[model samples]
Target: MVALRGVTRTVRLPDDQELHILRGVDLTVNSGDHTAVVGRSGCGKSTLLNLLGLLDVPTGGELTFLGTPVQHLRDSARARLRGEAVGFVFQQFNLLPGRSALDNVMTPLLYAGGKQFWRRREIAMDILDRVGLAHRARTMPTMLSGGEQQRVAIARALVRRPRLILADEPTGALDVDTGQTVMALLDTVATESGAALITITHDVNVAALARACYRLETGVLSAAAIPTGANA
Candidate 1:
C-alpha cells in the first residue's frame, strides 16, 4: 500500500520560471488494488510515479509506503527499499539492447540476493517462463514484437516479487490490439502476485480495467467510478 499526503513537487527553470508538477496531491493505493490515473499529457502522472517509486524526493509534504515515512530515508536505504518493494514499467520499455529477454528480466535480481549473477539468471528465467516467454527467452528485443517485448519487460519487473508495480503509460507505444494484450499481461501479473498496481494512462478504455480509477485535473486528483466489465 502507498499513500501521499499533500505532496507537491516544483522545479525552477534557468530563467527564474517555476514549474509546479504535483500540487498537494493526496492519494492512497491499497494492497491488491489495481488503480488507474488518467490525465492529459504533462499533467505530472509520471512525476507522481517517480515519487512513489522513491526515484525522486518530493519538494514538499510527505509520502509513506506501508506506513513507513520514506522521504527522510538515507539514499542507500531508499535504493534498497525501492529494489525490494517496487517494480517499474515505462512507456519506452527501457530494455537493454544487447541483453536477451532472459537477461533483461534477471537484471533486477542481480542487485538483490548478494549480486550473484547466475542466481539472478535462474530466477529471471523462471519469471520469463511464467510470462509465457520461455521459448523467447533467448531472443533479443529487436527480434521480438512489441507485445512480446513488453511481456519481457513485465517479467523483468516481477522478477523480484515486488509489492508495488508502477506502470507509466505502459501501453503507449503499441497499437490498440497489442495494447490490450499488454494490459492483460499486467493485470494477470498483479492478480497473481497480489501486488498493488498503479497504471498511469490517458486512455479511458485502458483505465476501466482497474478496480479504481482517478482523473487528474488542474493539480487535483478525483476518483472516478467506471462500469464493471465495461472496458477491461
Candidate 2:
C-alpha cells in the first residue's frame, strides 16, 4: 500500500551546510505485509519513518500511499490522509496524561467523521478488549502498568482501523517477557486487522518476527535475511 523510490531527506544547518539524512532509499509495503527495519541511532530511521507516515516530505524522489502520490500534497491533505490511513505506535506510549484508556483511544476518532466519531467509545472499548485491556478502559495511564499502557497505545492506534500501522520500537520500554507478550499481541492484531505492519526496531529478535527484514545504515535501506530460529 506504500512505495518510496529514490527518497532523500536533507536538512540545512545554520552555517548553510547541508546534512543528508536519507540517501535514495527505496521501499515497498504491500497490504497485510509485516516488515521490520533495524537501524542504529542517527542512521536516518526516524526520518524514513516520518516520510513513510506522511508527517514529513522527502526532499527528492517520490512517495506513494495507496496509489496516490504524496510528495506534492499540502499539509492539510497530508494530515487528513495520515489520520485516515495510518496508525502509529511509539516506544514511549504517547497517551494523554489525564485521559482514560478509552478516551485516549477515542482521540483519533475525533479527527474521523460520521459514525466513527459518534461511536468512538464503543469502538475504542472493543479494540481495548481485543488487546486484553477491557477492564482497564476506564483507568488512567498512570494507574496502568507498562504493558497495559502499551496495550492502550496499541488500542489507540488501531481505533481508526488504519490500513498501515507504524510501530517505532514498540517494546523498548518493557521487560523482556513483557516485550515478548506485547510483540505477540501486536502481530496478532495487525494480522487480524489486515493492516500492513511496519516496525522500526534495533533488535534483531524483534525484526525476526516480520516476513521481510531490512537494515538501515548510512541513510540507505537494504533487505536482510531473518536468521534461522531468530523468531521470538
Candidate 3:
C-alpha cells in the first residue's frame, strides 16, 4: 500500500524557473484496491506515477510505502523496495528492441536472484501464457501487432507478482476494441494477484472500471464521481 500527503513535485527548468508538477496531492491506495486517476495532457499524471513508483522523490510533503516513509530510506534501500514491490505498465509498451517476448519478460527476474533467477524462464513463460502470449514467446516486438506487444508488456510487468501495479495510459496506443480487452486483462490479472491497481488515463471509459476515481488537474488531485461499469 502507498500513501501520499500534501506531496509536491517541483522541477527546476534550465532557465532556472521552477515548474510545479504536483501540488498538495493526497491519496491513499490500499492493497487489492482498484483506483483510477483521470487527467488531461500535461496535468502531472506521469509525475505522480513516478513518485508513486519510487522513480522520483517529491519536492515536499510525505510519501509512505508499506508503512515506511520513502524520504527516510537510503537510495539503495528505496530501489530494492521498488524492484520488489512495484510493476509499471507503460502506454508505449516499452519493449526492448531485439529481445523476444519471453526474453523481455524474463528481464525483471534477472535481478531477482535465488530461486527466482534460476527459474526465470519458467516463470516468464507462465506469465506470457497468463497474458495469452505463450505462443508468441519467441516473436520479436516488430513482428507482433500492437495488441500483441501490449500483452507482452503486461506479461513482463506482472511476472514479478508485484504488490502495486501502476499503469500509465496502458491502452493509449491501441485500438478501441484492443484497448478494452487489454485493460480488462490487466485489471483482472492485478486483482487476481491481490495487487493494488492504479491506472492513470484520460479516458472516462477506463476510469469507470475502477472502484474509486479521481480527477487530477493542474497538479491537484480530487475525488471524482465515476459510475462503476458506466463506460465499460
Candidate 4:
C-alpha cells in the first residue's frame, strides 16, 4: 500500500551545506507484506521511516501511499492519514510517564474519533489481552519489566488495527528470548489482520522474521539475502 521511487532526503546543515540522508531509494510494500530494513546507525533508516510514516516529506522523488502522492498532501492531511492508517512502535517504548498501561494504550483512540474514541477502553483492553498483558493493564511503565513495557507498546500500536505497522529497533532492549517472542507477536498480529509490517533493525535475527529484507547503507537501499542461519 506504499511505494517510493528515487526518494531522496537532504538536510541543510548549519554551515549552509547540504547533507544527503537518503538517495534514490525505491521500495514497495503491499498489504500482508513483511519488509525489514537493516542498517547501521546513521544510515538514514529513521529518515526513511519518517517519510513512510508521513512525518516528513521527501526532499525529492516520488513517494506514494495507497496510490496518492505524499508530496501533494498538506500537513493536516498527512497527520490525519497517519493516525488512521499507520501504527508505530519504537525501541524506547515511549509510554506516557504517569499513565497506566490501559490508559497509555487508549491514548491513540482518544484522537481516533468515532467508535474508536467512544469504546477506547474496551478496545485497548482487548488488545492488551491479546498481547498477554491483561493482568498488568493497570501497571505503570516504570513498574513493568522491559518485556512487559514493550508488549504494552505493541498493544498500544495495535489498539486501532492500523493498516501498516512500523517498528523501529523493537527488540533492542529485550533479551534474546524476549526479543524472539516480541517479533513473533508482531508477525502473527500483522498476518492475521492483513496489515503490512516494516521492521527497522540492525539485528539479522530480527530482520529474518520479515519475508523480504533490504540493506540500507550510505543513504542507499538494496535487496538483501536472508542469512544462512536465517533461512533455517
Clashing pairs in 3: none
Minimum summed lDDT over a 10-residue window in model 4 is located at 223-232
Candidate 3, residue 230: the lDDT equals: 38
Count of steric clashes across candidates, in order? 0, 0, 0, 0
Tell me how far the alpha carbon of residue 44 in candidate 3 is from the true structure, in angstroms, after superposition. 0.9
The reply for model 1, stretches above 4 Å from the true place, is 114-118, 227-232
TM-score, candidate 2, is 0.97
lDDT of 3 by residue, 190-215 (tens): 98999999999998778888899999
Whole-model Cα lDDT of every candidate shown, in order: 0.86, 0.91, 0.93, 0.93
Off by more than 4 A, model 3: 227-232
Give each model a TM-score: 0.93, 0.97, 0.96, 0.97
Native-to-model Cα distance after best TM-score fit, residue 197 in candidate 2, in Å: 0.4
Q: Write model 4 residue lDDT over 8-75, tens digit each, in one string.
A: 99999999999999999999999999999999999999999999998999999999998889899999
Arrange candidates by lDDT, highest first: which order? 3, 4, 2, 1
Off by over 4 Å in 4: 228-232
- With candidate 4 superimposed using the best TM-score fit, by how many Å does residue 25's alpha carbon deviate from the native? 0.4
Give the TM-score comparing model 3 with the true structure, all chains together: 0.96
lDDT at position 43, candidate 2: 99
Indicate the residue-level lDDT of 185 in model 4.
94
Please write out the lDDT profile of model 1 over residues 49-122, one tens digit for every residue.
78989998889889998788887899898999999999998888999999999889988877875644558877
